[model samples]
Target: MQFIDLKAQYERIESEVRARIEAVLQHGQFIMGPEVGELEERLADFVGVRHCVGMSSGTDALLAAMMALEIGRGDEVITTPFTFIATGEMIALLGARPVFVDIDPVTYNMDPAKLEDAITGRARAIMPVSLYGQCADMDAINAVAERHHLPVIEDAAQSFGASYKGRRSCGLSKIGCTSFFPAKPLGAYGDAGACFTDDDALAKALREIRNHGQDRRYHHPRIGLNARLDTMQAAVLLAKLDIFGDEVDARSRLGRRYTELLTARGAGSTELGGDAVLTPFVHPDNVSVFAQYTLQVPDRDSVAEKLSASGVPSAVHYPVPLNDQPVFHVGLPGEETPVGARVAQRVISLPMHPYLTEETQLKVVDAVAAATGLAGS
Candidate 1:
């Protein structure tokens, strides 16, 4: 079984996707094409943001946002250490320091309570990742940013369809970025992403940064990279958007099924806590896109081995905290964020997708029970 069943999704949208691609092919304006503008506008409206600037990839989206914010040498951006390396990589690439913060044990998100203590004169931005498709406490995080005069950049790569307290993930912070990687909730066929914001000037700067800092044709004003999203990717995203909302709902339902089955609460389950696993904690104020439907289990490696043997695929979102990574290991103060470090040793992701069937989930949970010694021998 595939972890993220993109093939299943594609089957449902094949004709529509083909038609969109055909339109782009006829136009032949691959770079800075009309489809890119249309996708950006649609994405902006969906996210309740005033602007959306498309980019070549999720990494470039973050880079463009950092450039627009002028985050560079000697600057520090406070962020969680439990997320994908791209979060810290972008800051390091810009010659800025990523001040690693511990994640909350419950939600596994950046702990807002610890945010203020990490603030220094060099702290320019608060970048909180919406890990595993769930958003962090943006209200509390934003409050700290407001008091300290720092901008909040929501890394919503896994959370495009997620909502926090009636607001969308990308629209919750001062600036937000999301990916169109094939496995994301709302994804394109190829690598793509967009930066979202309400600030007019920041939006303009982001657009320029993604286009070699061009103010007009061939007029380069500042140092930037070629990060424009391709027209084909934009077309795919536009087509995906047609059923994206419905897919989000399906993901949520499927996620609930997994949780129920794993917990021994599904149909015909006689035991409780079937796998002795800890399901993802979604905050009451937020709704996740259920990008991965990950679970924390004891003896993660053994469980994963058994799942693999059973043909039930599983993976880890992060195997090590960012501070512990070799490249970013500067041994600075607050060097090791204990929560993320501890969680990394035990977290394992099960097969998750909007199209995942309940019967398939039952088999996965049964394997989890057997692997974790919860199933009665």
Candidate 2:
């Protein structure tokens, strides 16, 4: 089975997608066309934000937000190390330092208890990534940021449709940045992303930043990058946005089904036990979009190998903590982030998509059970 069933999704939305793309082609305004503005408005409304500035990619969205906040040389942005490199890379790109924090063992999200200790006078912002389509504890993170007088930027790339408390993921922070990387929960056909904010000034700054710091044509107001989202991508996203809510609901149902099946089958070995393969945890106050349906499995490598050999595709969300990566490693072997380090070795993502069939899902669960020696149930 496909790891992510993009083909099925496309088939479901083929007519709408085709119509949107056709409109874009007929308009012949490829760059910053009408569809771009249309998408921005639609996204802003969906996120309940005053503004949504579409950008080139998720990475660019993060960069644009940082630029708008004037986060540069000598500044520090606090974040978890158990996420994609882009989370920290954006900070480093701006000559700022990424202060690594550990994640909660259960949620695999940035641990709020450890967050305060990592903040220093140089801390400009707290960027918390909503990993695997589940939001980090935004309320706790926001409290800490409020106390420190720092802004919070939710790296909501994986959690576009996720909700924290009563608010949406992208609307919970000072600035929320989400990616449309085809693999994300709410994806476009190609590279695209958007930044959301309630603050008008920050919104204005982000718009300028995305267009090479131009207030208008050729009017450079500040140093910026060409991070504008293309009309084609915007068109695709607008089409997808129409059905995103339904897709999120379908994914949630599938995630719940997986959890139920795994629990019923007792898919944990005697040596490992049922607790060893902890399913994805959803907070009582939040709703997960289940972007990856990742699980904590002992002997992750062996499990993945067995699944692959069994014709069941599986992958790791991240094998190594971002702080441990060669590019980010600063010869600091003693730097301790126990939670991140531990989770990095155990987390494995299974095939998950809104269109995943029951038969395919059963096969996936059976593979897991067989791999873990818990297939008897």
Candidate 3:
């Protein structure tokens, strides 16, 4: 079985995707083509934001957000350690420090309770990643940022279609960024991403920053980088938009189905005592896009083995905490983020896609129970 099954999604949109690509080719403006602006406008409307700045990749979207805010050189951005390295990597790249807070054990997101204590004088921004497609407690995070006079950037790479308290993920913060990596919820054919914001001045700044700091052609206003999103990639996204809403609904249903079946089998409940497994936690006030339906399992390595043996695919989102990474480590052990460190060792992501079938989910869950020696329970 395929882990992500991109081919399945592609097959559903092949003709429309080809048509969009053809239109891009006919325009002969591959670099900054009309399709690029069209995609930006459509995306902005979808996210309920004033503007959307398309960029080269999610990493560039993040880097440009920092540049637009002037967050660099001895500044600190508070975040969690249990996410992909890119979130923290961008902060460290700007000669800024990434101060970490512990994550909630259930949500695997930065704990809003511990957030304020990490704010020092140098804290310029609060970057909270919406891990595994569920938004972090953004309302609480934003309140803390408002009190501290700090900007909040949502690393919303995994949560483009997610919602928090009636607001979209990318529209919930000062600046939000999302990816179009082929594996993400709203993916393109190649590398691309976007930054969303309601603030006009910040949006204007981000537009210039992505285009070599140009206010106009040959009029350089500041130092910047080449981070423009490609026209072809934009075209691909435009086609995907036709079915995006339905796909999101399908993903949510699949996520709930996984939880129901696992709960029925007592696989992810405490009834068996030793953490048979743990399901992804969705807050009552929000909706996750289910970018990945992750679960925490004991004896994770053995469970992975059985899944593989049963031809049921699985993967780990992050096996180690970002603070423990060798390149960024300051030779200090990451004892502060105890929950993040503990969960990193146990969390595993099952195959999650809008097209996931009931039979496949059953097979995957049965493999899990068998792997954990709970098949008869």
Candidate 4:
């Protein structure tokens, strides 16, 4: 089965998608087209935010957010090490230091308890990633940031449709960024992203930053990058947006089903206590979109190989913690993030998408059970 069934999703929205694209083509305003503005309005409303500045990519969105916050050389951004390289890469790109923090053992997200310890005199911002489509503990993270008087940027690339305490993922922080890299929960046809905010000045700054820092035509005011989202991509997103709510619901249902089935076969639990896989744990207050239904298993490589041999595809959201990456590795050997390092070694993601069929899901689960030597419990 496909790891993410994008083709099936395309088929479902084929007509509307084509119509939107056709309209963009007819208008021929490829750069900052009308559809782009329409999408921004739609997205901002969906997230309950006042502004949504469309961007070139999720990485660019993060970079722009930091830029808007004036984070640069000598500044530090605190974030978890158990996520994609883009999080730390953006910090380093701006000549800022990326301070690593450990993740919660259960949620695999930045642990709020570890937040204050990571902050320092140079700490300029807290960038917490919402891993696997579930939001990080934003209320706790925000509280810590408030004490430090620092801004919070939610790297919500995988959690665009998720909710935390009745608030959407991209609307939960001072600056929230999400990706549309064709693989995310709410993906577009090509590279795209957005930054959400309620601050009027920050919103204006973000819009300018995405367009070469031009407040108006040929009026350059600040240093910036060409990070505007393309009109075609915006059109594609607008079409997908129409059905995104249903897709999010389906994904949530599938996630719950995965948990129930894995548990029923006696191969799933909350922790890695035995041979069974340790399933993902969503906080009681959050509604996860389940971008990936990840689990922790012993002998992860062996299990992956077995699953592949059985014609079941699987993937690792991330295998190496950012602190261990050659480019970002600066910590002493003994100072590794205990939980993030350990989880990175064992975490694996199974195929997940809204269109996943129960028959195929059962096959995947059985393959996983056999791989972990827990078949039939």
TM-score leader: 4
Give the winner by TM-score: 1 or 2: 2
Instruction: Please identify which of the two predictions, 1 or 4, would achieve the higher lDDT against the true structure.
Output: 4
In model 1, the clashing pairs are none
Would you give me the overall lDDT of model 1?
Answer: 0.87
TM-score of each: 0.95, 0.96, 0.97, 0.98
Error of 1 at 266 (Å): 11
Instruction: Please identify model 2 stretches exceeding 4 Å from their true place.
Output: 267-275, 330-335, 375-377
Q: How many backbone clashes does every candidate have? A: 0, 0, 0, 0
lDDT per residue for candidate 1 within 1-377, as digits (tens), equals 88889999899999999999999899899998999999999999999999999999998999899999999999999999998999999999999999998998867889999999999999999999998889899999999999999999999999999999999989999899999998888888889999999999999999899999998989988878899999999999988899999998888788777776666632222222324567777777888888887777777888899889999999898898889888877565335687787778878888888888878887888887777765441
TM-score, structure 1 vs. true: 0.95
Off by over 4 Å in 4: 272-274, 332-334, 375-377
Q: Count residue pairs with overlapping backbones in model 3.
A: 0
Question: Which digits, one per residue and each the tens of the lDDT, describe model 3 over residues 1-377?
Answer: 77788899899999999999999889889998998899999989999999999999999999999999998899999999988999999999999999988898788889999999999999999999999999999999999999999999999999999999988989999999999999999999889999999999999999999999999999998878899999999999999999999998998899999998888777663222145587888988878999998888888888888889989888998888988898766545658787888888888899999888888988888887777766453
Estimate, for each residue in 1-377, the C-alpha lDDT of model 2 and write its tens digit.
89998899899899999999999899899999999999999999999999999999999999999999999999999998988999999999999999998888778899999999999999999999999988999999999999999999999999999998878989999999999999988898889999999999999999999998999898998998999999999999988988999998999899989988887776432222224777787888888999899877878889999999999998888988888898888546426687677777888889999998999998999999888776452
Off by over 4 Å in 1: 265-276, 330-335, 375-377
**Model 1: residue 36 alpha-carbon error in angstroms:** 0.7
Instruction: Choose 1 or 3, whichever is better by TM-score.
Output: 3
Instruction: Return the clash pairs for model 2, or none.
Output: none
Which scores greater on lDDT, model 2 or model 4?
A: 4
Clashing pairs in 4: none
The stretch of ten residues in a row with the least summed lDDT in candidate 4 is 267-276
